[model samples]
Target: MRQHQNRSLKERLSNSAFCHFEQRGELPCIVVQHPGFTASLLPQGAQLLSFCPSGDTSWIWLSPTAEYQQGTSLRGGIPVCWPWFGNADKNSPEVQAAMAEGQPLPAHGFARTNRWTLTRLYEAADRVEIDMSLPQSHHIQSVWQGDAELTARWILTPTSMEMQLITTNTGQSTLAFSQALHTYLPTTDINATRIGGLSGHPYIDTMTGWQRKQQQGDVVFQGETDRIYLQQASPLRLVTPQRTLLIHSRGSRSTVVWNPWITKAQRLSQFEDNAWQTMLCIETANAADDWVNLAAGANHCLSLRLTVE
Candidate 1:
């Protein structure tokens, strides 16, 4: 049955000029080779693994040792954190209360590990667009009791790559969730990497007992860092020795900046010990004190746009 499905998917996607199905170890993925850029996307979790614009190196950072197997989350690109971000116990009460009693909650929810259904693919002279949705099935029912639908869309153009995460409440009651576009970007030198547009904003320092502190200047990497900046209002500029990337977001009031540095990098899966020095995460999020509550039949959309110069 699995083989038949793979064959059908391959035939269907292969008809497109720029998109086709390919196997990556134990997993199946779509490879898009548009005139503007090239991208690799996995239906599993609807995860994007790589994006390289024409004439430039990859703006997205994927792990060298990342695994491509069933039931395992890849270590890089943009992981769609959904339903709840991080520890369920740390989420807002409304999000926590929605989970089934005594059900084991995985970090960053279950969206990233489940296979999503491809819903749409459209190509044009200058761009390509793709959409995938999380199917309601045993995977969802096992962890959640509410009825909600998740749809992710991507648009690739010569100058930018954009993503939108849309959540709809299909149940009769209200729905609550936290989510993030956990984007990992690469840097040739971590010491020279700096993030702008967050000065004076307050952040929760998760590594320092979750204390709240103010951002005094452009955020720079020094050691193991995990922070959730609150009430963010502007786009973030990531300046590295390799290139400059701009991150613009909507429907997000928080941004998570993280790097495992050295010590924790040794313990991370699908990551090399020195990988931390070359990658940093600037997540556009609705997490920590920022969460979403949707009324019955309502929908919410979180979007992120990435451009390099």
Candidate 2:
């Protein structure tokens, strides 16, 4: 790590022993190597595409069919779902209100597709930090009300990885929206994975009439599963046959657990139907009744941390 800090940016890029930074064709990316972990980041949307601890393979399950093209949401990795959580047509009252009048709004807002500026990227003795910001411009003020900026930062330490999203409402009036770090995690098998810590919350099951139900035990995926657990922000554990993944978060109001089984999995672009068995999402979010009411000049932040046993 001392070597990383001593090297200049050019030297660091050229020296693979410290770090790797390159503009791959048009997609710029950076990979940091600390004694405890290795992590990668993409400038597009300020996304964290990969992370692996000293003795592990990749814990993030990136899609084999992911497209690295600009302006397109890559199939996997942690997607920054801000200003909204789903389709604008679906209409969470606050999300619909922020959209440009009469224009077809994109899925999960504009933060993910926009190219974010790297605010800071540095290596220290114990870890590496990469911070980025998506500062919205006035040219799109006609599209969305309020002046706001979104930032995502990654902290790669020896034992765990932390990612945070900070939103600042720079304009007057209040801003209302739901957001999430839509994170896709690796799984040995969907059937063998059990999610703990969501056992007692009231959740809306997306597969069956959007009905609300209480979770009785650790969540297990049998068929298709999409549920929004309201108001529960406890640390969660993903128990699989091979290992257990622990997730802890702060400033997050809701948790969404989703797995597209047979039918829905078949319809998704850049995703293989049978591939669903290898990955599942336990998203730390502010969705449903948990929408944020950010006042003028105020700020809000949501963060997630991951560890494994």
Candidate 3:
């Protein structure tokens, strides 16, 4: 007979709040908490970071850091930046020229640095809802002609996690941009883990001069892996010997999977020496080569769901 032990109330609460939660369909969810943010996860351990009154718990770090750097101020939670992805070099003359024309900011655009307002919070029978919005900033206006709005919603249950991002162009002309949900995941060993789901797809390796290649098998961790997967019709999967994480998306034209190990992690003060072995970045996005074109007075939406078994 298989022995079954029920979890203690404290354990359940801790898991539900900090680690896991039980919902319908025998699904379990994880919870991530910090001072200001409280988010739930699916049994598969996929977390949705919800911005709340107290603080945010989402991880934030530079390229070389393995662990997320803790923010000193309330304004510094894991920010979701848009319009541009990756570095905005301060020393680059080309970047400076763009700034001179009003497109100024550091790498990965201004969305992550800007503050977002929590618009709604409620609970349904089996799920919790969270909503946040980012409006056009002066910096954004200087670079782009019209106003823009980004609205994000998180709906969660113990068995599932869903995120929706809606971008609206309030300006006069069309808005061309790239966007992504930069998710940082914790693991036991990144090098030992193999990401499934794109077994036979093609990807562009940004680290290797943007070379395109067909994936023969599951994605394995080796050194520094930076790839933007184009035309990916398969779901993204992260499988360890002990756990498996599945990421599903709709309306996203691209996916980005990255890891900076060893020497890269050594350069960042925020990361511990072995931290890179425990984290991964698998983002569902429309970025880089695949930019979005939003017409004036129009809106575009992207959605992602995470599940673990």
Instruction: Return the top candidate by TM-score.
Output: 1
- Candidates 1 and 2 compared: the better one by TM-score is 1
- 156-203 in candidate 2: lDDT tens per residue? 877788999999988788888888999999887788899988878899
Model 1 per-residue lDDT tens digits across residues 1-309: 568767867877977989988899999999999888899999888898888988888889999999999878899989999989998899988998778777888999989998887889998879999999998888688888878999999999888989999999999999989999999899999999999999999999999899999999999999999999998866789999988898999999999999999999999999999999999999999999899989999999999999875
The reply for model 3, stretches above 4 Å from the true place, is: 1-79, 88-103, 143-146
Can you tell me which runs of candidate 2 are displaced by over 4 Å?
A: 1-17, 23-26, 138-142
Each model's lDDT comes to: 0.91, 0.81, 0.59
Instruction: Evaluate model 2: give its TM-score.
Output: 0.91
- How far in Å is the alpha carbon of 95 misplaced in model 2? 3.2
TM-score versus the correct structure, for each prediction: 0.98, 0.91, 0.72
Clash pairs detected, candidate 1? none
Off by over 4 Å in 1: none
Cα lDDT of candidate 1 equals 0.91
lDDT of 3: 0.59
